[model samples]
Target chain A: MAEHEKITMAQAFNQALRDAMTADESVLMFGEDVGALGGVFRVTDGLTAEFGGARCFDTPLAESGIMGFAVGLAMNGMRPVVEMQFDAFAYPAFEQIVSHVAKMRNRTRGALSMPITIRIPYAGGIGGVEHHCDSSEAYYAHTPGLTVVAPATVADAYTLMREAIASPDPVVVLEPKKLYWSKDEVDLDEVQPGIGRAVVRREGTDATLIAYGTSVPIALEAADAAAAEGRSLQVVDVRSIVPFDDETVCAAVRSTGRAVVVAEAPGFASVSSEIVARVTERCFHHLAAPVRRVTGFDIPYPPPKLEHLHLPSVDRVLDAVDTLQWDDV
Target chain B: MPSHDFLPSEQPVQLLDQDGRRVEDPKRAFPSDEDLLRAHEALVVGRRINEQAYALVRQGRLAVYPSSYGQEACEVAAALVLDDQDWLFPTYRDVVSIIGRGVDPVETLTLLKGDWHCGYDPTEHRVAPQTTPLATQLIHAVGVAHAATLRGEDTVVMAMCGDGATSEGDFHEALNFAAVFKAPVVFFVQNNEYAISVPLARQTVAPSLAHKAVGYGMPGERVDGNDVAALLSVLGDAVHAARSGAGPSLVEAHTYRMQAHTNADDATRYRQDDEVAAWQGRDPLLRSKAYLTGRELLTDERTAEIAAKAEAVATVMRDGLMQDVEPVPGDLFEHVHATPTPQLREQAAFLADELSREKVS
Candidate 1:
C-alpha cells in the first residue's frame, strides 16, 4: 500500500490528471484557462509545466469549439480531459455535448467510442456569483449514452476522475466546487470502487438519506444530528448518476423502509425526483412512508447573498427526514 | 500584409469555362488528363447516385434524400483530393462525396433509411458519420488534424459544409482554431445558394463566404463549383497545402442547389424556375463531359462503361435499401457504454419478458 497523504479535493484532482497523463501517452488536458492559468479554480495548476504545451494547452475560449474538437481528438484515439470553467458556462456547448459527445458511440453503432471526460465544477454554497454555482447534473444524466458521476469525498475525487478518464464512453465528472477545499487523508495509489456503484458513508436503521456530490456531506451532517436526537440515519452517496446503482440504493432504502433524497438542484424533473420515484417503485412493500426529496426551489440559481437559503442544508435534509412517517408503522 | 492578400479573387477561380473552353492561369496549372478523366467518371457516378436516391425517396424506401444534384463537382473534388489515410468529415448533403471516397452506396444511405445512425465502420473508411447538424463537423476536423500534428503524423482532414453553415459560430471557431494551432484541415464550403429555403443573402452579408476566412488569418479561395476541372484544381491545392503542414485553408465553391433541399421540400415555393434552369445550363457533368471529349480522353466506349458502372451502383443501392431490416429489441440495451449497467440489464430482461409474452399471446 502507498503512503496516505492528507490533501484537498482540488489537489486530489490535479494528482489524478498527473497520474493519468503519466500512465497513458494519449491522455490530454485542454480548456479555456486550463493551460497557463491552471484553470480558474487552479484544479489544473502545474499540469502544463509538467506535461508540456503539446499535451496540455489552452483553447480559443469557445465552449462549443472546445467540446466539438474534443470529439474529434477522441475520434483520433486521444483521451481528452476537457474542463468547463463553470456550470452555466457549459450551456454554449450543450448542443455538441448532447448531440455528438453523448451519442457518438451509439451513433457509430459501437464503431467509435468517445473516451472524453468533461470536468465541471458544480453546486452552490461557496458564496460565488450566480452562474458559478449551478447543479447541472440532471441535464447530463438525462442523456442516455453519458456516464455522470459526482464525488464528494477527497478519495473518491481522485479515484473517480482517473476512472472517468480510463472509461471507453464519455463521462461527466461534476466536481463539487464548494467542496474543492475539503480535505482528507487518502491513499493516492489505492484502487477504489469503480463507477456505477454507490458507497454507504454511514449505516443506520431508522431511515436512509440518499445524496451525491454537494449533498452527500450535508446528508452525513444531518445523519450526525439525527443520531444525537435518538434517530439513526443511513447515508448512501450516489456516486454515479447515469448508470445509477439501483442495487445498492434500493437495498439501502429497503433496509430502512424510508428514504429522503437530497440535492442542490431544483426538485422539478431533477435527479432527486428520479431517485424518489425509483425508491418508491422498488421499496414500496418495505416502505413505512412515501419517499421525500429536499432540493433547491424551482427557480433560477439565487445570488450568493441568498444562496444559503437556496441550497439544501443539514436542517433542510433532516426536516425532510422527519416527514418520512416515523410514527406511521 | 494587407487584407486584400487574403481576400478571394473578384471572380471565383475557373479553369474551364461553362462552354468547356480552357481558361489560362499563370499561377495555377490544370489537372492532368488522368485526373480529369477520373473526376469525370466520379461526376457521372455521383449524378446517377442523386437520381437513384430521388427514386428511392419516391418509392418510400428512404425516409428522405438530400440530393447533391448540382453540387457534384464540389462533392467529387472534395473526395478525390484526399489520400487514402486522410479523413473526410462530410455533412448530410455530401453522400455523393462519401460515394466518391468508395464507401458502399447502400451503407451511405443507412442513416437516411432510419436503420442506424451510421452503417459502415468510420475507422475502416476514415470517414466521420454524415453529420446532420450544421457546421458541427468542422471543429471535429480541426481536432483530428491537431491530434495528427501533435503525434507527428502526416494526416490532413477535409471538412465539408454549405453556405449557410459558414454563418454558424462553430464555423468561425473551427477556422480560428485550425489557424491558431496550424492544424492541417481544409474547410470546404459548398456555397450551394440555400439552406433548406434560406438563401445566402439571408445567411450572411459577407462579400463572399470564402472572404470570411481572412478574418481568421488563413488564405481563402473561391472556385466555380459547377466546373469540375476548377473544383479539382482548387480543392486539390487546398488539400495539398494542409497535408504539407502549411496550416488550414478555406475554399468556397460557388454553386446552386438544383433540387429542393430534400425530397420533402418544395423548391418552387421559394425560387423561380428560370433560376434553376440557368444553373442547369452550367451542369457539372455536361461541362466535364464536353471538356473530356474535347481532350480526346472520353470516347463512346469509355462513356458507356462509366454509365454501366453507375447503373451497377444504383442497382446495388436499390437492392440493399429495399430489404427490410428487423430491429433487435435487445440491442436497445447494448453499446450505451462499454459495460451494461445493472439498470439496463433489468430493463432488457423486462423487455424480453414482455416480448415473449406478446409472442405467446
Candidate 2:
C-alpha cells in the first residue's frame, strides 16, 4: 500500500476530482465559480489549472443549465461532475435534477444512462444561514433513479467520490460542509469498501446510533460522551442515504434493541424519520424502547446565531440516546 | 445578422409557393426533383399516420394523440435531414417526427397509451423520449451535443419545441449554452401559433421567435413550415453548420395546428374556422404532392401505390395497439433504478408473495 497521509475532507475531495479527471479523458467539471475560484468551499481547487479550461471551466450562473448540461453530457457518453455551490442554491436547478437528471435513465428504458455526479456543499453548522447551508439528502434519496451519498470522513470523501463518478447511474454527492476541514489519516492505496454500504465506525453494546453525512460526527461525539457515563453505544454511518445499507442498520438496531437517528434536515419527512421508521419496523419485538430522532426543526433554517439551537448538537443527540430504556442494562 | 439573409421579403423562406408555383430564391439553391419526390412520399406517410392516430384516439383504442397534421412538412423534413448518427430530442407533439425518423408507430404511441415511461428504446433509436414538459429537452439537446463535440464526434443534435416553448427558461439556457460553448446542436421551433389554449403573442413579445436566437448570439432563420423543400433546405443547412463546428443555430418554421392540441382540446374557443381554413390552403402534404406532380414524379398509379403503403402501415400499427399486454407487477419497480432500493425490494417481494397466495387459493 502507498504511504498513509493525514488530509482534510476538502483536500480529499480535491484529490478525488484530480484522480477522476486524470483517469478519464471523457470526464469534465462545470458549474458556477468551480473554475478559477475553485468552488466556494475550495473543494475543486487546482483542477482548472491541472486539467485545463476545456475539461474544467466556469459556467454561467444557472443551476438548471448546469444540471441539464451535465445530464446531456452523460447521455452522450461523457462523465460530467457539477458543483451546485451550496445546498440551498441547488433548489433553482431542482426541476432539472429531479425531473430530467434523476429520471433520464429510467425514462429511456435503460437505453440512456447518465453517469453524472452532482456535488453540493450541504447542511447547517458552518453558521452560513439560509441558502448557504441546508440538508437535502432526503429529497434525492426519495428519488428512485438517483444514488444519494455523503462522506463523513476524509477517506470516504475521496473514495465515495470516485465511486460516484464510476457508477452508471446519476449520483448526488452531498459534501458535508461543516466537516470540510475535518482531517484524518487515509491510506492512499487502501482497498475501497465501495459506495451504497454502511459501516460501523464505532462499536458498543447498548443503544445503536444511526446517522449519515454531518450527523455521523455528532453521533460519534455523543457515543464518546455515553462511554464516559459507562453506557456503551454503537455508531452506524449510513454513507449512502437512498439505497442505505439496511443490513448493517437493521442488525445493529436489532442487536441493541434501541436506536437514535440524527440529521440536520427538518424532522418532517426527513431521512432521519425514515431511519427511525425502518428501525422500529425491523426491531419492533426486540426493542427495549421506541427509536428517537435528533434533527433540525421543521421550520426553515434560522439565522446564523440561532443555527446551533436549530441543528442537532451533540448534547441533543445524547439526550435522545438518554431516552433509551436501561431496564435491560 | 452576420449577412445570412434567409428571412427576405419579410416572409418565411419558400421554394415552391403555396399555389404550387415556382418561387425559388437565388441566394438559396433548391433540392433535386428526386429529393423533392422523396420528401413528398415521406410527408404523405407522415400525414396519413397523423390522421390514423387521431382516429385511434377517437375510437378509444388509444388514450391520447398529439397530431402534427398541419406541420407534416417540418416534421418529415426534420427526420429526413439528420444522419442516423445524430440524435433527435422530440416533445410530446412531435410523434409524427419520430415516425418520420423510422421509429415504429406503435412504439411511439406507448407513452400516449400510458403503457410505459417511454415507448421506444433511446439506444435502439437516435430519438430521445418525447418529453411532455416544454423546453426541457432543449437544454438536454445542448448538453448531449456539447458532449459529442467535446469527444470530437462529428454528430449534431436537434431539439423540437413549439412557439410557446421559447418562453421557457430552458430554451433560453439551451441556446445560450450552445452559443457560448459552440455546442453542435440545433433548436427547431415549429411556430404553430398556439400552445394548447395559449396563443404565441401571449408567450413572447419578440418581433419573431427567430429573433430570440439572434439575442442568444446564434444564427436564426424562419422557413415556410408547409413547404417541404424549404424545411429540408433550412434544417439541412443548420444541421451541417452545427456538425462542422459552426456552433448552434435556431430554425423557426411557420406552421399551423390543423387539429386540436389533442383529442381533448376544443380549438373553436380560441380561433375562428376561417383562420383554420386559411391555413388549409397552405397544407404541407398537398403542396409537396402538387410539387411532385409538376415534376411528373407522382403518376396516378404511383399515388395509389403510396396510399396503399400508408394504409398497410397504419393497419399494422392499429393491430399492434389492439393487442393486450401481459403486465408484470414487478415492472413497477424495475426502471426506477438500475437496482431497486431496499424499501422497493421488500415491497416487491411482499407483492409477489401475496399474488402467489391469491393464485393458490
Interface RMSD, every prediction, one decimal place: 0.8, 1.2
Write the residue-wise lDDT of candidate 1 on B114-196 in tens digits. 88888888888899999988999999999999889888999999999998888889998899999999999999999999989
Top-scoring candidate (DockQ):
1
Q: Quote each prediction's TM-score.
A: 0.98, 0.96
Predicted candidate 1, C-alpha RMSD: 1.3
What is candidate 1's CA lDDT for residue A227? 97
Per-prediction DockQ comes to 0.84, 0.74
Give the least accurate 10-residue stretch of model 1 chain B, judged by summed lDDT.
B1-10
Give me the runs in candidate 2 sitting further than 4 Å from their true place. Answer: A1-3, A327-329, B1-9
Candidate chain B TM-scores, in order: 0.98, 0.96
Per-residue lDDT of A205-261 in model 2, one digit per residue for the tens? 898988888889889999999899998999999998867888889999888888889
